[model samples]
Target: MHLPIDLVMKIYYMILAVIGVPVNLVAIVILSRGKCGLSTCTTRYLVAMAAADLLVIITEVILRWINLYYFPVSFLDITPVCSVIAVLKRAATDCSVWFTVTFTFDRFVSICWQKLKTKYCTGRTAAVVLATSCILLSSKNIPHYFVFEPWVIIDNVPWGCATIPAYVTEPGWVGFDWFGTVLTPLLPFAAILLLNTLTVRHILVASRVRKRLRGESKGENGSDPEMESRRKSVILLFTISGSFILLWLVYVVHFLYYSIAGINPDYYKDSISTFAQVGSILQNLSSCTNTFIYGVTQSKFREQLKSAVKYPVSSIIQLIKKKQNN
Candidate 1:
């Protein structure tokens, strides 16, 4: 059944999200605990983005499970639930994308214009950037809330809810769908790609310059530690976000195909539909990969995680010793 597989996926997603939620919370806590005045710009931005992703994981994915298995939409008061669900889902998904874009731009600035490091990359400016992104995404999502309604299904195994027929004629439904599915993803993805490419190139040249300055001719082109690390971050982000773009691109292409050409290839309908949902869920799951990426790439995050992990171990040992002493 559709739901049986979905249920399996939900279970897997829950396990991963459970880990992501608390880790993100800790990252937020660490970031908050810092002396983050206006000067600590990129640091604050990354941690804030982490916190937002955490909230999204909890509210969107967790609640998704509750609705999917526990209470099908038909059994509940559909209006408020769907509205809340819609908002949470949109906010979380949009937050992931926008925040990633923010983080990428921040990196681009630090690398491209070193002056920006001192000038524009302040905590206050970062906050403004984040606030502006949220406002924009929310404004874009307003259409979804206005247009969607409780979809009643007859003779389906269990009543399900979906955004009501967006296919029908109206002034701007098609445009809205394309905007969400393609325009938003494409525009930002494009910006991120451009910035990331430039950043990597700069990092490479900078590394070569630094190595030559030090007269250390004992390494390969990308083997410099800092340069290699930044290169990996660029690659990781590209791979992660590239997967997301391709997945959404399929949906966008399919939607456009039907709209313009009235062609519904059965192959696309079955496979692509499942791929879009399952892949989106998995891609969302991959958001947690950033935290791990931080652990691997950023020494500070790794050290902190190590200490956090060891602290419990030490505490448990001390407890056993105290009991022995007693």
Candidate 2:
């Protein structure tokens, strides 16, 4: 029996919420402890990404999706409350995307530009960049709150949030929408691609030069620690950035199609609607994949994750044995 698409989406989001939250939390906890053999600056960026992903799951999936599908009536549905939630959701998503861009750039600098790496790749600089990005992105989303109006007025209170019709027609809101879209996935998409290309080019040239200098090109077998280290860094950076591109690619295409055609998604044909929905699903899934990427790319991350998983189970077993003896 074929289940309805809506039902399938609901199940998917429910599962996403359950898995996304704890995994991101685990990632944050593990990465923050600095035991993964990653540099402090890299750790800070990763922890921030995980934290933002956790927030996206809470605000977008649990609060937005589960609430919309399951609990239709709640304080969270109140227009003002829901408006704030909408703003927070956008801000969290923006920070999540932009953080990846910044992290990619940090790795690029560290790999390609040694002179700038010492200053730009420091933990202090990372903290500052993250904080500033968070603040600016959050501020940018404030206008989103004003774009929502009450869906219904019951007695004296606004019951739900509805987009103000002017949001689509008015030049100001339309311009803001364009600005937001450009600021997020669009700009980030281009930035990551360009940065990765440059990083790859630099690495290829440097590898060849280093090989000749170390006499490896002439068959004088010797291990070059510098090249080995660069290989590890390149793997981590490429995996994370590549995952981002692949996951977000559908959503970007959907956005481009609808925007270029000037068609409201609500009026899309069945096929187009399904396409848009798939894009959304993929983008939301993107929020949860970084932890898995880390596990796959970094051996130390896998070790840390295993230790974290065992600690609670081992504690519970010991506690049970002690109580039995008592």
Candidate 3:
């Protein structure tokens, strides 16, 4: 029936890592070019998102490659290695959220409200948003460093991987799991829902406005034909945002089940491990999928991605020809 847990996690992570490289690399380049009709203010935030996603894919590749090739069962004895991976995981996820939510608010202001085009929204402003979000998230995760200290004895022994033990930290902080995972990320989910909703609503309202304008000019009776096309694009973009929310919700639910219910993790250990891997990978997909969403829904990001990918290779060939001539 079910595959071995470790085997499944190894395979899943490996596969997702393999998939993430090219996808997120494309994101990094497209966003970097600022060619996606991206305003100066908003491009940097998504660039940070793309960059963070790129680094995250790298770490995922390392962890997966190590898990599959180097040390499948144990062998990761270096506390700093684990700590660094864990820290980077937190950093990437945190920085990514900051970029994501900042972009959400950016869209809200730029599209829905239409006031920020002239105001305090520029490349520098997006940079500051990225910085602030990273700082705040880093502060939140700082406790992990002091709390997850390596017991020298644990490493010296031969018990598979050096494990992070439970209940070894300060008593007050020891069991406050509910406050950590569920409640914290939920606030961000709520914000995402609110802002993304407003953005979608505004996009819809504008489409209607354009259709009304079109119909009045053409002397048509009911609705403009182009309205259907705009509606499909809006729906597709909404689906991308919806994907982010769904994956995070699954993660939060499972996390709350473990933390709040005090369920024996072993009972659902197989499922917990499986879903965790899936959710983790899918969440990272959000970082890369932004480019795809823009590519599909916007046309401009797609053309830009195509040109960016092609132009560099053409330049390399041209350079080679000139060198040969010289």
Candidate 4:
């Protein structure tokens, strides 16, 4: 029997929270150790991305979704508290998307602009970039706090957060909403595509030139270590960015439709509502994908993941052996 969409979504989010939390934590732990055969700058970026994804899972999936579905009434539902959570959720989401953009750009520069890569792709620079992005993005979401009002007043205390009715029509709030939308997935989508396109173009040209220089154009087919290294980097870069683009595509389309049609999602018809919900599901699903992408594209990451998976069993076996000896 087919289940209700609402029920399906509830189950989907519960499973997502269960998987997303530990997956990102594992990725953060593994990448931060700097033993994944990634450069310091790349490691820093991956760690930051994982941390941002983890926060997204906590705020968006667990706190917002699970709390809404399961708890229904808790301290987190208080107007002020939920407003802060709203800001954090938006900031974390923005960081997650923009971090991917930043990493894509870093890889693009490293592959296409060798001279600039030495200066821009250093660990210090990566840290600076990530910190600045975090600060600015977090600050960008501060205005969201003021957009909410008490859902209900209970004996002088605000019970829950609801967007002020004026949020849709008021000039300032409308402008802010538009600005935030444009700043995030919209700009990020364009940026990643543009950067990836340029990187691919550059690599094709460079490969041809390098091949001729290595005498492969004439007859001799020899190994080119530089190209091989670049091939791996390109694979990782494309997989991560491509995953982001595909997963976010539905959300982008929905956003355009609703914004252009000037229709609030709350008033959507059943089919349209399901479409919107699916878009949301896909969007949150993006948070869980980068870890799998790393595992697939980076051999060292897979190795580390294997070791992490075995550590508990290994420890248990050692404990059993020691007990027998004792």
Best-matching candidate per lDDT: 4
Prediction-by-prediction clash tally: 0, 0, 1, 0
For each candidate, what is the lDDT?
A: 0.65, 0.91, 0.64, 0.92
lDDT of model number 1: 0.65
**Candidate 2 lDDT over residue span 204-253, tens digit each:** 99988988888888889988888888899899888888888898889888
Q: Where is the poorest 10-residue window by lDDT in model 4?
A: 258-267
lDDT of 1 by residue, 1-326 (tens): 35666667667776766787887877776556563221277667767678767866776666665455555554433655666667767766787778778877876786678877777777888888888988888677766666555455456432334555543444377666657756456676688778878887887788778888766766534346766556655654565455556545654555565557533333246655675566556555645666665665556666777777899899999999999999
Which is superior by lDDT, 2 or 3?
Answer: 2
lDDT, ranked from best to worst: 4, 2, 1, 3
TM-score of 1: 0.77
Q: Give candidate 3 misplaced runs (Cα > 4 Å).
A: 1-5, 72-76, 147-171, 174-179, 182-184, 203-239, 263-268, 312-326
lDDT of 4 by residue, 15-89 (tens): 999999999999999999999889999999999999999999999899998898889999999999999999999
- lDDT value for candidate 4? 0.92
Better of 1 and 2 by lDDT: 2
Better of 3 and 4 by lDDT: 4
Off by over 4 Å in 1: 1-4, 34-39, 73-77, 152-160, 166-168, 208-269, 323-326
Error of 3 at 314 (Å): 4.0
Score candidate 3 by lDDT.
0.64
Error of 3 at 73 (Å): 7.9
TM-score, structure 2 vs. true: 0.95
